[model samples]
Target: DIAHQNKREIYNLLMRASADAVIRIAADPKHLGARVGVTSVLHTWGSAMTHHPHVHMIVPGGGLSEDGTKWIACRKNFFLSVRVLSRLYRRLILDGLSRLHKAGKLRFFGDHAKLADLAVFDAFLQPLRKIDWVVYAKEPFAGPKAVLAYLSRYTHRVAISNSRLIRVDDRGVTFRVKDYRITGPGRHTTMTLKTDEFIRRFLIHVLPKGQHRIRHYGFFGNGNRTANIARIRELLGAETPVPGLAHDNTIEDADAPARVLALPCPCCGGRLIIVDTFAPAQHPRAPPASARAAA
Candidate 1:
């Protein structure tokens, strides 16, 4: 609710704090002692189109030395400590929220109106400071192909997809949703909401104007990203990466073309064959406004 009310401030704070947490922790000699780069993408909606704001980050396992002379690599099969990251992230976000409240940048409404008062707002944030905020770091991707595959899922996803829309009528807008609590096939279910409510939920994810959903930090930052990447590649002796690292089997290869019936039919377990193709029909135009009003 707070995030929806103050989308820009809250999301900006999340990005800043998350990036700061990783950079600070990794910079410490006890951890990795290097300046790592981070690419973060902000997502505001969950599977059911609920307002669940989160950031996904992709960080390389190593970084350049402080003096810019050598590369510092992390221990095998280990990155930074989750506990350390969680603690630091919690502090940074809470501190940032406090600053926002003090600067009168935050808003409160309806039942939460009392939070406008300093005491009330501090009380609200007290429990958050005590409890650990989760900052889960999954195992590193297997290779560049795995990294590309993982990033493809979230980098450009929307609140909902057309394929999930089951129906739309006077009853409501029925759509498919996944219940994360369920363990198996039973997790998939359908949900229906009034058209007005559906629009309201969808609009919650539309970011404030000019607010970028994806941002890069450190070496991947905009100003000198290309040069920084080239330097890093030179240092790692990977200036020329292997063809397999860049290969994606999902795309057709021009040199070695695939068979016409290489792909299987979606509905049947048979090879798909190309048939005849035709131009698409144009959609009918809507009646004039005068006619619509008269009707």
Candidate 2:
């Protein structure tokens, strides 16, 4: 239950981290009073392709002044220091989680059941302090075009691509998992998993109903997005996308299920047989075969 709870939306913790990040980044006088525009994309993948949830924030290093008069930009390559961001992020997340526990908003189950007691909860969260929760920063995508390319690959991706699955049979399914195998001379390897187990592992990542897995915060808050965009435009004093400059890329991979067969369908734990699959580029609106559309 704790695992489920942890994976589900922790809105308060998310917001707290966002706020702290914006505060730290914006408070620096070196920004020369530039505004901030950031879109935080929630991602839950590590090198192992496991459910290590984290955020990939797309931010313009600098923004227009609040008055929409001058454009500002950060240094060419650096965003805030990852070390600082990690420390701040962990603290803010923990503090918010603690607040939720105190307010009786957090639910505990399994071995976590004892967390109902304040002392027990404190002890449980204590170890979190010792472990440095991972915070990584890839060099910002090149320019607007590069940023778009990067997002195209991740934004709508499902738990696992159908191409990764070799086959699904009654004798435990078999599917390919990423082989982070190093290349030395002619050495290469790919990992595979059994079907039932694959579905089980994939199911672990299925988010709850109506949970906005990816969200934006700070100056990029949805409510203020339009006005903010206009403000930013004015600050930049840069011409908008040239008339013919506007272009789009659309790719259609062979239809396949974005998830592996290992995860069971919530409705009956039935195997989610692939009727079709769509690539990240062409994310078609569709419902999960295993469950009703989340309201």
**Candidate 2 clash total?**
10
Check candidate 2 and list the clashing pairs: 160-258, 173-194, 173-195, 198-262, 198-263, 199-262, 199-263, 200-262, 255-277, 256-277
Q: Considering summed lDDT, which 10 consecutive residues are worst modelled in model 1?
A: 242-251
Q: In model 1, what is the error at residue 96, expressed in angstroms? A: 0.2
Report the poorest 10 consecutive residues by lDDT, candidate 2.
243-252
**lDDT values of the candidates?**
0.86, 0.64
TM-score of each: 0.81, 0.71
Candidate 2 ranges with C-alpha deviation above 4 Å = 1-3, 9-12, 15-19, 30-33, 45-50, 66-68, 179-189, 241-295
Model 1 residue 92 CA deviation in Å: 0.4
Candidate 2 residue 81 C-alpha distance from true site, Å: 1.6
